[model samples]
Target: MLLKKSPSNPIQAASMGINKTEDQAISGWERLRFLYEQPSMERDLSRRIINMAFLTGFFFGGVATSAQARETFERSNIGQRFLSASDVLKRQADYAIVRFAKSGFPMGFKCALVSGSIVYADFLKIFHCG
Candidate 1:
């Protein structure tokens, strides 16, 4: 029996009664080629502008957050001597223990520990301390 080759099928072409050159040209590789058309110059420029704006906003947002954290730290006056998160984490342990001891069980100790941990986390986020 003769197999009729469809232009879209190569296996049919290989076993076909008549092999057309155009059918042979539609290889598996053609499907792998990029299907999307290139962006127009205006579209490309707008994309670039949008990307830059997003990056700029991201940078400024980080800066603003850090500044706000620094202001909060200054206002709190908890550990004025400690400059960064690493310093706070290292030295605050002693303070935490002392406060825990003075304040004692359940409520006081928990409050001291939780507050200290939260402050350390905030400092780490803003300062990216080692």
Candidate 2:
């Protein structure tokens, strides 16, 4: 004959929903603490931390090296093409401005840098050049 298994403690029964009201009364932090106390949870947390640290270091190192490489490239002749292009554009713009002035039309021009910002701060407007 097999004996029927039974709860060995009152709180065990209360925790098992035999006392649904008591279980519902447990705070969210208390529930999280209970789940976090498991060995499986501890192992998972440690693994996640290690993975995150590795990824962060890899990305940070990549960005630092790329920045240095970009600076070096910008100093080379090929990279100086950007400045030559800008000068050509300015010449064309100046020619257009002279033509527009001779035409005497109500035309206006603003030659702002590509990497500049227009900012409004406390009733003051400022144009920042890159």
| 43-74: candidate 2 lDDT, tens digit per residue | 35544554555455545444445444444444
lDDT of 1 by residue, 1-130 (tens): 9984364554334324344475354333221121112333433444455455545554444444554554554567654666788987665554445443333333433443443333212111212344
Poorly placed runs, candidate 2 (over 4 Å)? 1-39, 75-130
Error of 2 at 20 (Å): 36
The regions of model 1 sitting more than 4 angstroms off are: 1-38, 74-85, 89-130
Each model's C-alpha lDDT? 0.42, 0.40
TM-score of each: 0.29, 0.27
Worst 10 residues of 1 by lDDT: 119-128
lDDT of 1 at 103: 33
State candidate 2's TM-score: 0.27
